[model samples]
Target chain A: MKLQRVLQYAKTLLSESIDAGDIAIDATAGNGHDTLFLTELVGEKGHVYAFDIQQQAIESTENRLKENGVSHLATVILDGHEHISQHVQQQIGGAIFNLGYLPGANHHVVTKSNTTIEAIEQLLQLLKIGGIIVLVIYHGHEGGKEERDELLKFVSSLPQKYVHVLRYEFLNQKNDPPFIVALEKVKNFPKE
Target chain B: MKLQRVLQYAKTLLSESIDAGDIAIDATAGNGHDTLFLTELVGEKGHVYAFDIQQQAIESTENRLKENGVSHLATVILDGHEHISQHVQQQIGGAIFNLGYLPGANHHVVTKSNTTIEAIEQLLQLLKIGGIIVLVIYHGHEGGKEERDELLKFVSSLPQKYVHVLRYEFLNQKNDPPFIVALEKVKNFPKE
Candidate 1:
């Protein structure tokens, strides 16, 4: 059997963690690819919150969802995902974050470490037990290494009692291939 | 769905790579658990070679295979895995190495970097196209950290054109939980 690539494994994780009628989130909503994926996973009974900071991304995701006739299942929000706790208050079964910039768009507006960590913290709080948060980290561009390093440091510090943080990476590849950092909630919220 | 632990993922990978009549190897047949597992995976039609440096390990594995009534399908060897090139000269479908000391045995007798890397090189040579070699690295014991570091370095430097080196690790766990390093042979051989 062929080993799944980064994106394929990411989708596999989401598919395994999410079921029909379960709430999901596309934290990046880049090109609307993952948003559309989440919509199908949650189905009509479930709902998806698609977040993006750029108007272009929001428009792209909205158009993709509309074209797929799945607009009703997902909310395309033109806001940073760090504010997800504001838009989505209920527990979610799964979420995905594609770090770095929107493909074929401005590379300057990449996902930074601080906001990304904040979004992760909020999502972890809102995640159901046994739920997963999949981060497809793309760190091939300028200032990308810093973000990747910071994100790795932050995730490594997460307490193991409540969550299991897994890092899936290809070591021999060139061109800084994207890697996956998946966090599975093993318990409820962290104890105060 | 709950994420698979290290051992489960290792078996899943082996099962996916090995066919019913394929040749397989247990590079470190510690207590023979993985050896027995591989025997089932390869089935009665296939063959397995299990190797260990310790006499006790070899005896235990031999007994387990005998008790399980599959002793005829596997050959137990009381030799270091670094000598794989001498005993096995055929292309293999898959192999597994459980690094570190044997469980419930002397923790000081752990696998080291030089011999581990040598065995990996030999296995890669003997692995058929699309075959895989899975390494379950347990690095919490004394002298284990150095071996882990060296092994990671060696695997990372493998040419991407011929091999795909993947590191599957858990970041948040307090203890150094065993992680998986899976190498898939994508090409016949690396160019000199």
Candidate 2:
């Protein structure tokens, strides 16, 4: 299978639950690929809240959405995903996070562990039952390792009564091929 | 998604490569679930080499296959999979291993890391190009953790040029849910 197989698999998983008019989030709108995918999945009535700290990334995503004529379905935000709770009040149907620095942008400005964990926490609270959060982890660059390690730790600690977290990664690949970490909120999740 | 979603996902991945009338193996025929699955996938012309250390498992698998009217396509062996190379000399298209003791059987008799790893090594040699090995790891019982740890280490060390190892595991699950580790041989594998 190709390296892109995991992404395809992620889309399949999301498509199983998400339908037209559902609300989705692009936790990291790098290059707008995921944002565009979400827009198409959510259709016209649905809304997508996309977050990116880089202005260039937000602009690029906005342009890509406009090009695809799906801009109406998305709200592009030039802010950290850690602040997701402040912007999104609707129950989320699904969310996607492509973790790492924006490609072709300043590599120094990266997604940190604290913010990622916080964003995930907020997303979990706002997630509808059976909703999923997909994380594509790219940990080959500087600071990437730390983010991956911390995220895995945090994800592993999530209570099972609420959600199921899945980690899909290639074990034998070199240069740290990107992996996917997904969380699907359980049906009839117990109240904490 | 249900708890069996990962298993279904594993079947999907295997179906991508395996075709009718192809040789396959069930390294651990626990209750004949995978054995039956492989038998159907391989069809009437293809053969399936099924191994289980427990006679009960072999008998169960044999009975299940007979009930399904596909017993002719399978050879049930009441032996460990570590000796798979000795019985089967032909190249294998795909293999499945449900690690841990057979459910409802004697839970003490478990698939240890040493023999499990040995079977995997042999299978790697026998796997045809584009063939896959699907491992459903049940690492919650006694000796399960060690096997999981050692197997992860072993799989992580496999050369990327030869095979791609994919791990699918849930992070937030009580009682340690089973995970899948798959290895797909590369089409243009380098000659060792």
Candidate 3:
């Protein structure tokens, strides 16, 4: 598989064979690739809540979904990190975040580690048992490395009983295009 | 989580709930990271059948495992693609192939699509229901694009009912370091 195919493999690992009515979340809906994938995986009966800080991103994703005849299954939000918890009401089966700027757009207004960390904290809480959150970190630009490093630290500290965290990257790569950091909530995550 | 942590994630996805007595296969035991992970996941009662075409690879993996005190739980073989079925007698819980050649070693002697495709077919027959096969394909070098493209085409053509296939890659990256392709044999895979 090439670079794009790896994300799909991660999605499959996070997918469950349960009924299609289960909810899913897209923490970042850049160009709607993941949002579209999740919508298909969850089927017509399912619901998808997508978030993006950029209006351009939201509009592009919305157009993509509508053009593909899947807009009914998705709800795109044009808000930053803090709005996700209040916007998405359902206990989701899985959530995904592509943590970088929208491809082919302004790279300067990219994701910050603080907001991403906050958004992830809320997303994890919203996940159900056996649910997963996939965070794809891209550290090629100026602020990228800090976000990647901080996110790794945060995920590494999550308790083992409640979650299993995994990071995927190629050490040989020079500029650090991006890598995958996935969190799977154990089926029996301990209750407080 | 660094690069090794990604392998840890792969390990959890493939063998999270498997007991201590399950059989597993490390198709490309390069440097033995996945081999050792498989050994630990399977426990002492279980067994891991690891394969590598290169004598240097098998020897290096064996040494790594022995140093880690896990050689007893795994059986390292100095055979290529076609020998997996002969080496593993029991139904496998999971099989993993880090499909590119040995890293930091000669890039000339890498995995070819022909042998890999054949091996995948055989392993599919050997896998138990609900079993998984993960292929981490690196398409960064010469001849990589052809192999990767062929493998993707092969996996994508699989029927929907029996086996669910997933391809994961970072869409935003160049050089396309490597990505993941996974196949899960459903419980009700066609028996006829």
Candidate 4:
């Protein structure tokens, strides 16, 4: 198909923003897929921060990274992504958030809009100019719709002069499929 | 920006489907920019069909194609796009529609939802497998919103087994910014 699927398109944006030796983040490390992908994109010289609130997610991500021999390149944190600002101090090339519950895990433990927004706010401050923060939103489960709607509202209100918000989705699919919302920082916000 | 803007994304999809020696169509023609582009996409050995209801649009498109030294590559027709099947019978590699009133033209004389859907229906039938139809939707003017809504409803209902309907838009911008809805035919439909 000429149109890229949601997962492929998410990587495309992240790959475009990140180069070898650049810093990246997997906001919700889930099954360690994106974290591992980030390690490959940034290479050994670079660093990745994988955050997950659940111990199972963190352990799985760490094992996957170590099995690939890139464990040292990423710091797996067992904490909510809302505490990202506390963990990451340096500028980042790109970040990705798979905003839903972990697959095969508890369905109720999904990412909420408030903490997601807080994490996004901190990421925006940490993102260098031209860097992107991609959100792959899955809204099929209970409470998913509310998170998606609230996040859309917040992102839509972001000033165009400082940010560019892109919404890419497939409209004709059956199940409520996940879509991508990418935020690119064009200019620095006034020091607050 | 890593995320392609509306116009560029439309061209990207069209270019992907069209080859040097294939047929293409500019469903709206408008100011002739996309018509001229279609001519270039299909080289000297190929053909393009440009349709518009306004005489001024046909004239401008003709002039533009002539100035570009490719007027012979296209057949400029002064008629509504709903009558597309009557003018062309060959399978098309790709097509594009700039839906709504022609830019810089009278806003009152806008393209309606029914006729636009008719044109789309005909285009889908004529599109070869893997061919695409791109619609750059501008819905700020009078009657624009209605057309946009109706078009979305129609496109969203297209069977995913044979077609992939992609909606690409930037949501942070103020002025009702234009967005893209690209339909790619992945498989042939059963004969009716």
Number of the top candidate by lDDT?
4
Question: Residue by residue across B1-192, what tens digits does model 4's lDDT show?
Answer: 777778888889999999988999999998899989998899998999999999889989999988999989999999999999999999999999998887677777788999999999999999999999999899998888989999999999999999999999999998799999999999988899
Q: What is the DockQ of each candidate?
A: 0.76, 0.61, 0.04, 0.90
Q: Per-residue lDDT of A1-192 in model 3, one digit per residue for the tens?
A: 122234664676556522387788888898988888888888899988888988888998999999999999999998886678888867888888888789989989888888888888887787777777888777888888888888777876777666767555433233454667777776554556
Supply candidate 3's per-residue lDDT for B74.
91
Best by DockQ: 4
User: Could you give candidate 3's per-residue lDDT for residues B18-103 as a string of tens digits?
Assistant: 45788888899889888988888899899999999888889999999999998899989999866787777677888898877798
Docking class of 3: incorrect
Candidate 2 per-residue C-alpha lDDT over B66-160 given as tens digits, one digit per residue, 9 for 90 to 100: 99998899999988999999999888888998889888988999999999999998988888888889999999899899999999999999888
CA error at residue B148 for candidate 4, angstroms: 0.6
Deviation of model 4 at B164, angstroms = 0.4
Candidate 4's residue-wise lDDT over A77-119, tens digit each? 9999999999999999999999989998998899999999999
Instruction: Kindly state the number of residue pairs that clash in model 2.
Output: 0
Q: Is candidate 1 or candidate 4 better by TM-score?
A: 4
The candidate scoring highest on TM-score is 4
User: Residue B134 error for model 3, in Å?
Assistant: 0.9
DockQ of candidate 2 (2 decimals): 0.61
Estimate TM-scores for all models: 0.97, 0.90, 0.53, 0.99
Q: What lDDT score goes with residue B112 in model 3?
A: 92
Which one wins by DockQ: 1 or 4? Answer: 4
i-RMS, each model, one decimal: 1.4, 2.6, 12.8, 0.7
